[model samples]
Target chain A: MAFLKLESLRKAYGEFVAVKECSLSIGEGEFVCLLGPSGCGKTTTLQMIAGFVEPTEGRIILNGADITRLGPSKRGLGIVFQSYALFPHMTVAANVAFGLEMRAIAKRERRERVAHMLDLVRLDGFADRYPRQLSGGQRQRVALARALVIEPSVLLLDEPMGALDALLREEMQIELRALQKRLGITTIMVTHDQVEAMSLADRVVLLNNGSVEQVAEPFAMYEHPSGRFASTFLGKSNVLAGDVSGASVLVGDQELPADLAGMSGAVDYIIRPEKITFAAAGGLVRGQVTARVFLGDRWLYQLDTPVGPMQVIDTNVGLPKAVEGDAVGLVWAAENARVVARGAAS
Target chain B: MSRTPIALHIFHWLFVLFMVAPLAVVVLVSFTDKGYISFPFDGASLRWFQAIWNQKSFIDSFWLSLALGATAATLAVVLAVPAAMAIAWHRFPARDLALALLMSPLMLPAIVLGIAILRLLSHLGMTGSLAGLVAAHMVVVLPYVLRLVIAAAAGYDHALSQAARSLGASAWAAFRRIELPQLVPGIAGGWIIAFVTSFDELTMSIFVSSAGTTTLPVRMYNYIANTIDPLLAAISTVLIALTLVLMIVLDRLFGLDRILGGKA
Candidate 1:
């Protein structure tokens, strides 16, 4: 059964539509990520769910209750803001105990819960310290503890790790994912970082221009994007203009077999960089490597091919396979290339 | 990090002397042993300071001024907090105009304000009432309170309130727990400034106060008009000490730069 449902949710500011007809059904305990670039309405959609924003039109049903008209305080959802939003004047224990106090829980019970939550977030020793005294990662943990100590039905994270450094961000991401799994609370996170979304979410909902572009598992969305925006936004992709005839796509002079899904005229063939390889002899197409970038784990080669400008990534096992200015044949599996209708936004 | 040049260092000391000369002269005059205001006295005595205790009007007026300042400052702060929050957080129509109206007292000449307030109080039959005096003083001091609180509100992280609400705190609860504590420094600083401004007010208080409700400043003005003595100088010295103590407290509780410089 669907635990939370948003039906045709739309939010408009004057003539600008921030979220246009968004609809989704999330199951219980599912970790969903709203991934998109800035101004893509991912944050707006999350805000609507959290009751911070009221939709211009539509209904929000949570746990079999129509909560579209509910106020944020009445919604009882846990939210971690991008700034962490810890009370600067309050100690860590007092900050975490705030929600419990709001719920009118007994003082003894609130103290016990606050202590347990501090221990859970591994800040047991620093409970008396204020937020300004803690490091960025420690502050982030305190915010999480404050939110989760309420035992809310849904947990919402709005780029909670945005303030942390790259290394701290990764460490917190692992800790957050592990914590979510253990609690089995329905969690929704909004982030522009695709790598973070892919690593943290069970399902990634890609949005563009105030609409959902694609909703799929991380691997499936990356492999089979529905349109041009999704194909490029989730990860880098090489797009080549092509003509479809029968079961093959004709680009330049090479006819490459692609799953066109029947009706097609001018189409775009999308292929991931890692899917393409540097073939030594007699391969799909001939190209010269224009630029080569070593990305630690992979060698990224920018090439001028007969089809168009293309990119290929090869794993860095030992040494360089193809350097800049080298003539190389680019080859990929036929199933790896995807064909989509031309000029489609999503 | 760099040493002051000889010329600039001498200029700084001269500026300090220029500012303190009047107050220093007043203190020196208060210690004179002569009957009148004389530069070179025969000897130093504590008689002028003792004279302040013997004067009933001055003693009563001193307590009245303290009560009036504390009351007016507290009232101004109470009204300014909500006004500052509204002006800082919302985008309602005439927000800037409302803020300007609250702060207009600062721009208006004190004599003009005094005459206008005196006319209103007379028509309302409240010219000599304590409430009338407090209301006039609140108007003078509100701008200082409002400006600091507005600055604090602007720099506050509004997301903290949202986080509280999301964690199931109602609007009132969130304000009490999350918003009020964060604004303490601004409130305390504004109250101190308001109290000092109200205590030193003369033009407006002179217009509003009658014989029964004379404040210490008005009382001193009347006494100086009647006689020339070091007794007034002794009272002035006491006021100077009180102001210094308040300034030190303000600086210790909240950094002077953060409060007066509006650094938030």
Candidate 2:
């Protein structure tokens, strides 16, 4: 059974539709991420679920109860804002104890629970410090502890790691994921960073123009994006416009094998950079390397091909397989390429 | 860092001296033994300071002014906090107009406001009442309080309130525990500013005050009009000291630089 359900939710501010009939059912203890670029309604959808923004139409059911009209205070959900939003005037212990205090929990239990939460977040000895005195990562941990202390049914995080540096963000991501799983709490996080979503979430919901484009496991969504927007937004893709005919896509007179399933007309042949391999000869498409960028663990090669410009990523084991101005053929399995209908969402 | 030029530094000192000269002269004249307002003291004496204790009206007015300023400032802050929150947090129709109307007293000339308020109070039979005086002072000090509170509220992280609410805090609880505590610097600064402004106000108090409800500044003004003596200078010196103490207190509690620089 679904633990939470957003049923045909739509939010419109006059003529502008912020979230257009987005629907999803999340399983118990599921970690879902609403992933998209800015203004893609990902944040709006998260806000609706958090009960901060009321939907113009539709219902939100939580734990088999219709909570569509419930106010945020009664939602019983934990939330960590992008800015952390830790109470600057309160000590770390007091900040975490706030939720329990609001619930009218007794003083001794509040203290014990708050202490335990501080330990859980590894902020045990820093309980008396104020938010301003703590570093960025420490403050984030305080926010997380504060939210989780209430033992809420679901935890909502809005760009939780956006404020942290890259290294700290990665560290926090692992810690947050472990904490969520250990607690077995349902989690919904909103992020524009695809890498963060891919690494952190159990399921990634790709949204565009106020609608869900695709919702699948991170690997599945990345491997088989449903449309043009999903294919490009999640990661870089070398999309070649081609004509579909006889189980093949013809790009600038260069035929490439594809699974069109008898569908005809214009289509976009999408292939990830890492999936394409360099060949000396007899490959799908012949291309000349235009530029090569060394990315520590990988070498990203830009190439000019018969169809259009293509990007290919070769793993950095020893030396680069190809250099700038080198002529090479690019090869990829037909199953690895995604054939999306053209002109739907470019 | 670049050094300030000697010419500019001299000009700055001259400007400071120009501002402090009159106050220094008042302090110096307060110690004079002469009966009149003569500059360059004959000899130092504390008799004029002793004379302030003999004047019952000055003492009474001083206490009355303290009560009036404290009461008026508290009332202004109580009203302004909610008013500022509404203006800063909501998008109601006429929000800007409401702010303008509330802050309109700052734009109007004080003497004009005094006359207008005097006319209205007399009609309401509250012309000489303490309530009327406090009402008038609240009008004068509310804008200062509201401006600071609004700035603080504007800079406030609204997400904090939402976070509190989502963590099972009721709206009132969130406001009381989270929002109000964060706004302490603004509220404290506004209250202090309002108190000082109301205490030092002269023009509006002159028109609105009765003999029974006279303020310290009005009493001082009346004494100056009747007799130009060193006793007046002594009272001014005492006020300067009190004001200096209040400034120190304000700075210690909430850094004056930060509050005045509008960071809160």
Candidate 3:
């Protein structure tokens, strides 16, 4: 058994289901991200595991203990809310000391632990300042220290860096990841940002509506998405509608090379835009550039291909100089295009 | 400094003087020797203050009113704090309607509230009791407590409670440690405002007070029905001074501007 397991969790309110039959197993000291768009029940799942929201049907097992029915305070999971939720009235030391104080730790011991935790978060000199006196990033560090002071079993983050400015958010992402790695804590973060998820998680569980869509290693999920939504939502992908025929797939009268293993019948698949390269004359396919965008590191071209509208991205080293209305030859590795199942948004 | 508009400057001072003139006349008349309403008098004395201080009925009723105001304001705080917490912190069906009902007394005429309380108390045969007076006074002051505390709670980030709970504090502990401290300013403001409201209330006291339970406001009204005396002016001056002291206390504690929802 894993260190933490969500066994077939389900939550519903009257006629509407918020999370349906969601199950996951997390190993010790592994970082996982619940990645999805809004209303995907990611936050709800994290809340249920934290014991803030009770699961209507399922068990949350932590270290072989059935804690699904426990209260949040009893579950002893550290949660960093998006708001950073530091108490305004209490100084930094008091806010961090509250949990220790609640456990009836002696005043001297509580003070020592608070100072140690503050130093851990690099806030040694801010012990006497109120939360309102700290900057956004400092306040977040205080919130982190407050949660970590209790030595909780799991650290749950609900869009932990959502409130910071863009530059500060990026900086905190690196700092937070470093801190999480150093602690080796069993951590789960909920985020809609694919980059943040891919950069932080050992595994990303993609959710759609009230159900799990795909869960895999971040790169594996991106490289070989299990469904159309995962393929498109995780990163840009050109989905080609094709019918598998014998050893090849037929795509709009053009039988592009493909690895036709067990997949058969009508299929929809994704080819990553960066995987496609400029082919020689009489290439695997022909396309005309309909639109183009210049990113700092790469150039994106929206091409009108025989299969459908396709996107191709090429690095800007020496600048590809692909212009609109230019005809281009495109080819990709046969195994690079991955077949995925069609799934509904709902 | 490009001189602010002359018309705007004139309006500002005129507004200030308009507000100050009534209170100024009361203080000046309270010092007069004429024993009646006196402004620009030939001579002045503190004889009326001495007269008010020596009068046993006024002195006794003054203490009665003080105790009633404090008791009623305390009760209102006890009732309003939790109610304001519930109303401000959670979203339920008809929440606005519930708040409106809680504050309906503020919209009702004082005479109406007085008569209604009188009828209810008389039916229960508890009329003219100190408890009845405190109960009537609670109705007059509850709205202030609700409005002030609700405004304070409005600025609160409820996620603080969740963070507290996650950090191993029980629900009660979370509220005690995280919420109560932040709410002190509003509670103090509410108590002071309610105390002043109850101290100045007269319409309900007239209907409820018997001779034994007569409040200072009722005694002053009864006294004024026959005599024109500086004793009345002296009493009014004392009440005004008491209100100023309370305002100063509130300013020192929570800043009066914050009670009115200003960024102090």
Candidate 4:
């Protein structure tokens, strides 16, 4: 059985729905990320799971027990916030000892546990220091230590690295993932950043407008998105509109073999930018390079074709360079494209 | 910038002199060795200070004011913090109306409130009592405490409380651990201002004080009415010194800017 199951969980504020009938089952020790843009209900769903928000409908089953109506305190869950909400007046040791104090642990044990938590977060000597004295990253670590010290059943992180700078954010993402792995805690994170989701989550749940668009492993979500929103949101893609004819697709005046089955009259075909290559001789479609942008390791070229403008990414590998307004042939393997139904665009 | 105009300079000096001249006169008269008040150059002595110390009534009234002010300020804070938190966090029906009602005392004239309380206390047969005075003072001081605490609560990061709740803290525990500590500066500031307001209050005390229950301000007013002695000057000097000390203490506890302007 899955460790945590959210069955048709719905959260609404007045007439506005923040999260629709969403159901997800996460196995024990799985690190899942709810990834979406702002107002996409990822945070709302996370809050519902954390018990900070009461879902308007549906049940929350954790370890086969219904906890839908349980208060946040009664539900044993640890949460790290975006702002790293460490108690400003308390010392690092006192802040870490708070959870144990609430649990009514013995003084000596609480002291030892606090010390151990401080050491775990690599702030052993800074136990007596106030939170204001610590840097953003150190404060974040303190928050992590404070939450993890509680030894709760599930861990929830809401945009945990959102407040850090770019370099520090990336560093903390790696550190957080490593820490979660070491602890083997069932973790769920809500993040709008796709890169962070891809780097940390075992599975990413893509949400759009209060509904789940797709839920899959990072690679699968990126390579084979079920909808336009999912494909575009997971990573960069070149989307082209076309009509399918048997095993081929008609794009304006050019007819190309369809990569996948079940594509109907009108469909949106998604191809990763990196998949398209420049061909000199025989190719699927002939086009002219309209624009070229050098992006350090690679060159991003926009090709004007019979269908539309197709974006292609190429590594700067000493190939005969294609300049702007230069005639070029664009080609990709038949298996590189994934056709999604047009109705799923929204 | 060009040199300030001569007329503007004179006006600036006039304004400064207007502000400082009365205080300067009080200080000079306080040190006068003569039996009565005088201005400018005075033969300075500690004789008036000794005379003021000789009176037991002034000393008793001073302590009484201090005790009442302290008690009222403490009571105000105890009442205001939770009210402020409730006002900040939840939106109950008529919340704004309730806030406006609680704050109405601030806009009302102090003498009117004092007279109204006196009439009510007389009806209840509780007039001329210490409890009555403290209760009346609480009414006046409550708005300041509530205003500061509300500002503090409003300024608090709601996410912090949510984070605490999500981390297994009960609602009360989360507020006690996360929200309350952050509000300490504002609460302290509110307490100080309330104490000072009650301590220096004169108009309200005039209407409410009985013979033995007269506060320092009422006693001071009566003393000044009867005699223009340097003894009164000495008392005024002491009050000024007390106010300065209280302000310094408040500044140390919670920055003066925060207390005066409701900025945390």
Candidate 5:
């Protein structure tokens, strides 16, 4: 058994299901991110583990104990909320010491531990400052320190950096990842940002419409997504609809090579935008550049191909670039294209 | 206090004068040795203050009003905190109706509420009792409780309690530690509002109280009806001073300056 286990956990309100039949296992000290779009039940799933949301079915196990029926306080999971949720009236040190105070820890030890945790989050010398007096990033650090001070079994973060601006958020992500490793506490974070998940998690679980779509390592999830929804949600993709034939798929009167020697039927395939490279001469197919976007480090092109509208991303390292309305050929290794079974969601 | 046109400034001061000049006249008259209300350029004395102080009926009525105000406001807060939190934080069947009913007392006629409470108290065989009076005043002041507490609870992030719980604080502990401190200012504001409303209440108190249980407002109302003396002025002046002291203390505790014009 893993350190923490969720077995077919589910949650429903009236006739509507917010989370349905989710299961996962986490090893000791592993970092996991529940990645999904809004209303995808990721937060609900985390809440169930935190013992805030009652699961409609299944059991949650932690360290050989079944905690499915336990209350949130009994579960002893530390959670950093999306809004940070620091107590406005409490000073930074008091906020960090609250859980210890609740547990009736000795006052002297509690003070020492609070100071230690504050220093860990790089919030030294800010013990007496109230939350309102601190900036956004400072408040977030205080929240993290407060949650971690209790030495919880599992640290649950609900969009921990959602309130920060883009630059601060990116900075905090790297800093938080380093802090988590230093503590070596089991962690699960919920985020809608794919880059955050990819940058932080040892494993990512993608949720959609209250169901688990895919669960894999971040790199595996990006390179080998299990289905169409997972592929499109994780990164930009060009989905091609075609018929499987002998050694190739017939895509819009052109043969796109695939390992379909025995397969014969309609299929959908996903090619990541970055996988398709711009070519000067003949390649897999030709398309007209409908749009071009100059991202800081890369150029992204939207191509109107014979098969469908496709997107190709290229490194902006002085590579040959195509402008909008320019005709270009795109190619990639045959194995880079993936065949995906479509789910009901778009 | 923001900058405004001279005309608007004049209008603002005139409005203040219109509202406060009557109370100012009462204060001025109470300090005079004159037997009746007369204000301009009179010799001042503390004789009326000593007279009201010596009156057993006014003294009893004053203590009765204070006790009633304190109990009613405290009870209103006790009843309203959880109810307001539920109404503010949770979605349930009849939530709108529940809020509407809780807030309806603010709009309902005081005489109607008084009569309703009178009938209820009479039916319960507890008319004119201090306990019955407190209950009635709680009902009267409940709208203030709900309004202030709901506003405070809605502004508060409900997730703080959840975070506290996830940090191993039990429900009551979470409430006492995290939620209560955050609510102190709102509770203080609500208590002051409720106490003031209950202290000045006369529409219901006259109907509910017996001769022994008469409140200051009820006694003062009777005195003004039967006599024309500066004694009424003295009582009003005392109540006004008490209110001013309370407002000053509240301002010190909770910054009423921000309440007045912080937004503008």
Candidate 6:
């Protein structure tokens, strides 16, 4: 049985729906990330699971018990916010001890647990310091320690690294993932950053317009997106709009064979930028280089072809440079492109 | 930046001088040796302060005003914080109307409110009581508390509260652990303003105060009306000092910048 399950959850503000009939099940010790752009209902889904937002419909079950109407405190879930949410008035020790105090734990045990948690976050000596005294990364660690000190059944992180600087964010992401792994806690994190989601999540739940677009492992989702939205959202992809013809797609005068069968009529094909390569002599299609951007290790060439503007990332290994307005040959293996019907873009 | 014109500079200084002149005179006269009010020069002594200390009624009224001001300010915060939170957090159908009603007391004429309270208390047979004075003072102080706290709560990072809730804090726990602490500066600012308003209140106190319940401001008004002496200056000086001390304490606790919403 799954440790936590959300079934047909919906949240609406007036006539605007934030989360619509979303359902997911998380296994014990699973680290799931709800990844989406802002207003995509990722945070709303996390809030609903946390019991802060009452769902307009459906149920939240934990270990097969319905907890749809339970308050946040009764749900036994640990949450870390984007801003850390550490109490400014309290010391680090006090903040970590708050949950224990609320549960009426013994004072000695509370102190012991707080000490242990602070140590776990590498903040042992800073227990007496207030949140204002700590650095941003330290404060975030303290917040994590505070939440985990309670020993909740599930841990939720709402863009927990959003407040940190770029360097600290990367460092904390690694540290947080390690900590979560060490604790063996069932965790759900909401993030807009694709890199964070890809690195941390056991499974990434891609949401678009309040609905699940795809849910899969990071690599699988990147390699095989269910639709145009998922392919473009998870990473950068050059999408070509065309109509399917028998086993091929007609692009102006050029006809390219469709790699996937069952693709009919008007469809969109998603090809990763890196998947396109330069044809040395002759290849699938011919194009003119409209733009070239030097990206350190690789050259990003924007090709203007009959299909449209196609982006290709090429390694700069003594390859002849293609300048702007230069004619070039474009090529891609038929098996690399994933074609989907136009209606699935929504 | 270019220098201001000489004429504008003089006007600005004169405006500032006008504001400080009355307060300066009160402080200066508090140390006067002569029995009557005088300007510029007077033999300086602590005789007026000594005389103020000797007056049993002044001392009693001073303590009474302190008690009343503290009680009313505390009551105002107790009533205002949750009201401000509710107004800041939700957009209920009647929220606007509710906020307007809560703030109406600030615009209402003090004499009118005092009279209304007097009539109500008389009907309830509780006139001339401390309860009556506290009730009236609370009416005047509440809006100031509410306005500051509402501004504070509105400016607070609401995501912080959501984070707390996601971290397994109950609604009450999130409020106590996350939201309430951020509101301290605002609540303190509100408390200071409320206390000052209640302490300096004369028009309202005049209606509610009886022989045994006369506040410091009411007593001071009667004293000044009957006699012009350095003793009244000493009392005024003391009031000014008290206000400054409370403001400084608030500044020390939560920086005066917070009072102005941390702009500077």
The lDDT of each candidate is: 0.91, 0.92, 0.88, 0.87, 0.87, 0.87
What does candidate 1's lDDT look like per residue over A74-107, in tens digits? 9989999999999898899999999998999999
lDDT of 6 by residue, A7-96 (tens): 999999999999987999999999999999999999999988888799999999998999999887788788888778777778999888
TM-score on alpha carbons, each prediction? 0.97, 0.97, 0.95, 0.94, 0.93, 0.91
Off by over 4 Å in 2: A344-346, B259-264
Q: For residues B63-103, what per-residue lDDT tens digits would candidate 2 score against the true structure?
A: 99999999999999899999999999999999999999999
RMSD of each: 1.6, 1.5, 2.1, 2.8, 2.6, 3.0
| Residue A293 C-alpha lDDT in model 1 | 90
| Per-residue alpha-carbon lDDT of candidate 3 for residues B161-220, written as tens digits (9 for 90 to 100) | 888888888888987888877787788778878998998899978998888999999999
State the lDDT of candidate 5 residue by residue for A145-166, as single tens digits. Answer: 9999999999999998999999
Higher-DockQ candidate among 1 and 4? 1
Residue A1, candidate 1: alpha-carbon lDDT: 91
DockQ of 4: 0.69
Q: Candidate 6 A-chain TM?
A: 0.96
| Model 1 segments more than 4 A misplaced | B1-8, B249-264
lDDT per residue (tens digit) for residues A1-346 in model 4: 7999999999999989999878999999999999999999998998898887899999999999999999888888988988887877789898888888888899999999989888888898999999999999999999999889989899999999888999999998998889999999999999999999999999999999998888899998998898778878888887778888778877776777666566578888778889988888767888888888998888999888878888889998876378989888878887888887787746
* Model 5 chain A: worst 10 consecutive residues (lDDT sum): A337-346
Q: State which docking tier applies to candidate 1.
A: high
Task: List fnat per candidate, in order.
Answer: 0.94, 0.94, 0.91, 0.74, 0.89, 0.55
Chain A TM-score, cand. 4: 0.96
lDDT of 2: 0.92
Over the stretch B1-264, how does candidate 6's per-residue lDDT look in tens digits?
998899999999999999999999889979989978887654888898888878999999999999999999999999999999999988789999999998998888989988999999999999999999999999899999999898888878776776566555667878877788788777888887899889999997899999999999899899889998889999888878987897798689767776746221
| lDDT per residue (tens digit) for residues B1-264 in model 1 | 998899998999999999999999998899887789988677999899998899989999999999999999999999999999999999999998999999999999999999999999999999899999999999999999999888888899989999989988889999999898778778877887898899889988889999899999999998899999999999999888887887798689777876676554
Off by over 4 Å in 5: A260-264, A341-346, B1-3, B39-46, B93-108, B257-264
Query: Given the true complex, what DockQ would model 5 score?
Result: 0.81
| Better DockQ candidate (2, 4) | 2
